[model samples]
Target: MDKRRVVVTGVGAVTPLGNDAETTWNNLITGVSGIGPLTRVNADDFPAKVAAEVKEFDPTDFMEKKDARKMDRFAQFAVAASIMAVKDSGLDINEENSEQVGVWIGSGIGGMETFENQYQNFLNKGYRRVSPFFVPMLIPDMAAGQVSITLGARGVNSCTVTACATGTNSIGDAFKVIQRGDALAMVTGGAEAPITNMSVAGFCANTALSTNPDPKTACRPFDADRDGFILGEGAGIVVLEELEHALARGAHIYAEIVGYGSTGDAYHITAPAPGGEGGARAMKMAINDGGLKPEEIDYINAHGTSTAYNDKFETAAIKEIFADHATRLAISSTKSMTGHLLGAAGGIEAIISVLSIKEGIIPPTINYVTSDPECDLDYVPNEARKQDVTAAMSNSLGFGGHNATIVFKKYN
Candidate 1:
């Protein structure tokens, strides 16, 4: 039997650049950096004082005020983006097909803000002062559970927690569910709200964050001057439907999800495998799964974290995997603008990949002042470009040696 076809019908995002998918895409094309001085807490002592924090976000805009108060910032972003995705997909899972719809959202570290706040409350006041919703709010799976309840999706509901690769794994697993004829629809993506003191301290202690004070100059992926990644927060959700289901309903089709591959380095707790062997395998698996030749790939949204090791290794992996085609492909790291959204990085980058397939525009990697010889590639360098992208892939590499790659093809 042949695998079932899957298509994306709707895309939604709450990013540092915009509150909605359209606005975010627009900002991405225009080369806007969302990173700024950290405002969620006092960053007087931290070396990396800037991040890509979401702006002008009000959970009450999508849900009731009372209900919003009960949710962590991560869950709040999940609910908000899911609502937009459902509305955009025009998928009303009512009495007819409620059982056939599913929700799968992932997060690397969920509700860090909540954990910090509740711990502070416990220390300052008492254990009794902590809210009863603490556990549910901090759990990573809450995003999927809340989204299922919000839209009445009764199909397979779960969350993938693969560090920064969480979002890509979630969407890939959901796509497999549909391809195997297990479900008809899945609301899947990633969300994260890890901009808290503990989160900052943990990353800073590990020396994973960029110490650059100027937010605009920070997160310089693939650049010789890049020091480290800047933390970011956001949510990105996509409504994926069976091809027949979407066509039957006349839903808007953004692009088709053709390939997904995931791998583990099994070599490190916080670094990629030597020379990105795991990452190369993931990309090769994705291309094979998509049944596309290396030459068919037109663009790549790199997992360039602006760290020294990642930039060098990921660049090497791409060149090794694609060989001569490496130079022919247009690749860039949108993290240069949005900073690193952690688990949500793959989610929004996947959305951008689909849009590039549909709109024929490639977003740029800003803040690229100087180039490294080892990290040589087009990188769409500093400006958006107009091109007919036939196929696009997004790569996400995370701590714990997790690597995932998803390929999107222009629906012909």
Candidate 2:
């Protein structure tokens, strides 16, 4: 049987850069840094002093206050972004079509704030004082559940939890669902609200977050002075529909999702495989799945977390796969501006990748004053570049050695 083609119809985002997709994309291309003094949790409590936090987001703007109260922040973001995406796509989810639509969202850490608050309630005032909604709110899958309930999408509801690769894997899996004729349309992405006390403390304990005091330069991906990622929170949602289905409804298509590849390093729990061997394979697989050669890829939204090993190894992986074309490819890490959204990183980065192709502009890796020898590629540093992009690749490598890659091409 012939596989169906999938295209991104709409995108929505709640990020440190902005609340909506257009605002986020505008801020991104302007090289804005959303990293600011860590305010979600008291910065003095931890070594990491900066964070990329979504600001001035009112949940009631998207859902009822009563419904919003039952959800954690991550779920709230998912619902809000999903609503925006559905609205943007102009995909009606009426009774006739509701059963043909699905939802799949993922998260790295779900409801850290909810868990901490409820656990405190349990410790101080006994389990009886805990909110009955604690279990539902604290679980990662509630994002997908809440979105489905809110949007009335009933076909398939699922979530992927592969650490930072959650969003990438979720979108990739959703793409397959459409390709295999499981659903006509899908709402999928990743969400996270992990700037809570415990989340920060845990990352600080593991030294996985940057301790840089300055907010402007905290996350300098591919730079020699880079330390680690800046913790971030948000959600990115996209509406994906089958090609014929999208065309029948006259839905606006952003880009065609052509390929997806996922792999496990099996080398370490925290660190990526040396030289990003697994990452290399994932990239190769995605390109192969897309029926494209390495040189055909015009841009790469790198999973450059600004960490010592990630940038170096990811660079190595690209060279291993693309060789000389690696230098010609316009690569950039939006994390330098939005910080690391962890699981949501891939989702939002996927949006950026699509926008890059649609707008023919590459968002830059900001604050790249110094270059690292190990990361010697054209990083499209400091300023956005305008170029016609035919195809783009987005990558995500998670702590569990999960490597995911997705390829997108101009719809035409």
Candidate 3:
């Protein structure tokens, strides 16, 4: 009774860099930063005034205007990315096998913009003025719900809410579902639209956001000058199919997800455990689950959040888990370009890891001007490198001390 094998057949993304996967991947490879001055919200209101926002996005381009109206921006991004992924996979969700398809999309904070607006409406007007779609749009699970309804996926519809690790956990859980024979194919990832007055004020109050006014250099992950993470918004999705199902359909396999590991610090509400012990365990679990030696890892897409504690702790965690191989593996933080997408960070980073395996190139960690003594590693800095990556790992550490890692291998 061997477990099933799951492979990524298609990828899609809606990020500040691009509206689709190819565009985003190209920008990432070219070392372009999508973060810019915060415009969606008034910059004058907050000390931290920059964000990575999906630019020039037209919801009607992906869904009917009326249909899009009911969904929060987060769910809209999810649905759009899901449609692209499913279409890219050439999956025909007909009645014959529609019931065998599932959708699992996660969001760290869903519809904060909607929540703020609806609350204001309630305050200014009355309870009667609030739209009925408020609750549906504000819940984190609505991304999965909307994707399922739009794609007609009837199997095991679900969502994971692991704060910043939501995307990785969602994808990991989807992999398990398919591996255990729960579905033939799945649309899974994470979405977020967290830029709002309350969201900004909350992070500002905690001093968790970067104070840098220049968007280009604000999110310098792994750099000594990095102050804190810059908020970002968007979505990333992948069409995961049973190996046999994808093979039978002649679908293009981007990469195979071979391992998933998750752990909790149980030490803090916001900070990682001392020395990133929990993250180390999650990394070890993922490596072991993949049945690979630590030295075999070619690259790491780090959860380098640009926060002082995270940068130092994650570096220590990597050294502890990878041992001598820490210096050998090429590591980078795409957040240097895309800003921290919160829950959606892992989703897009996972896509980038798969693309790295498929394309033989590793994206760079831009804005690496200065070095940090505690964070010493070969962060593919300033420029993308051409490397024949055989195996790649993506790490996502969230608030509440949640840590998750997912391993991807070149589909040989």
Candidate 4:
């Protein structure tokens, strides 16, 4: 059977650069750096002092003060962004068709703040001092559950937890649900709030975070002399609707979700597979799913985490998958500005892909001072470029060897 068409009707994000889609897109195009000295917590003693933190965020603006107090920061961000995304979609579902609407959002590490605080309370005042809401606040599925509750969506609610690939997998799974006639509309995306002390300490212990003192140059994706990724905190949510449902309601279309592919390398826990073979398979599968030739894809929103291995391996994967078309593709790693949002990387990057299709411009991979010989692709380095993007692809490779790719196309 032929698959039903799906379209992105709405987008919402709370990023290190800015909150909301417009501001994030603007900052991304202008090559702004969201990373800075860690102000959310005392990072003076930590090895990595810089991070891409969301600024001026008030949960009260999106939720009741009392309610926001109860929820963890990740859940708060998920609920808030979902509200914005649903509003953007303009799909005012009542009790009549509410069952057709679903929610699928993900996070890599759920409620790190909650875990830290509660664990600290346990350590200080014993186990009796732990809050009753501990379990509710700390589960990875809370983001999806809370968003569903907030929107009263009852259809096919689920969460995907593939480490950094969580967000992309969630969105891609939701897309398949609509395509398979499982649901007509889905609120799908990723949220992350893992900037806690434990998270920092863990990443630092693994040497996964950048120790650069300068925020602007911390996340240098594909650049020579890159150290590691800069942790970013935020949420990105998108409203996806079945084509007929969206057209019937006259919802504005940002872009069409044409293809999605996911694979696992079964390699190391923290590193990508050698040569990114798993990632290449996912890319090829996405292209095949789109029913388009590799040459038709004009841009690639790389999962360039600014880490030495990820940049080199991802570049190799693109070369292997696209071959000569890799040379023509305007590849870029917007992580230069947004840093690594972990699970939310795929969601925001997918939004960036849609925006590129809608705006006909590609965001740059900033801080590309010296190029790596191994990464020889046209990275669209350091500056945004204007081009007619007919089709675009976004890649997300997670810890535990998970890799996912989704393809988007400009609607005719």
The residue ranges of model 4 lying beyond 4 angstroms of the native Cα positions read: none
Clashing residue pairs in candidate 1, if any? none
Q: What's the C-alpha lDDT at position 92 in model 2?
A: 93
Clash count, one per candidate: 0, 0, 0, 0
The sequence of per-residue lDDT tens digits that candidate 4 reaches over residues 66-142 is 88877899889898888988898898877988999999999999999999999999999999999999999999899
lDDT of 3 by residue, 195-223 (tens): 88899999999999999999888999999
* lDDT at 111, model 1: 84
- TM-score per model over all chains: 0.99, 0.99, 0.99, 0.99
- What tens digits encode model 2's per-residue C-alpha lDDT throughout 1-412? 9989999999999999999999999999999899999998888889999999999999999999999999999999999999999999999999999989999999998889999999999999998999999999999999999999999999989999999999999999999999999999999999999999999999999899999999999999999999999999999999999999999989999999999999999999899999999999999999998999999999999999999999999999999999999989999999999999988998999999999999999999999998788899999999999999999999999998999999999998
Q: Per-residue lDDT tens digits of candidate 1, residues 1-412?
A: 8999999998889999999999999999999998999988789967779999999999999888888877899889999999998899898799789899999999999988888889999999999999999999999999999889888899999999998898888889999999999899999999999998888889999999999999889889999999999999999999999999999999999999999989999999998888899999999999999999889999999998999999899999998899999999999999998989998888899899999999999999999889899898889889999999989999999999999999999886
* Candidate 1 TM-score, true structure as reference: 0.99
Model 1 clashing-pair count = 0
Give lDDT: candidate 1, residue 406. 93
lDDT minimum window of 10 residues, candidate 4 = 36-45
RMSD in angstroms, all models?
0.8, 0.6, 0.7, 0.8
Quote the RMSD, in angstroms, for model 2. Answer: 0.6
* Alpha-carbon lDDT, every model: 0.92, 0.96, 0.93, 0.92
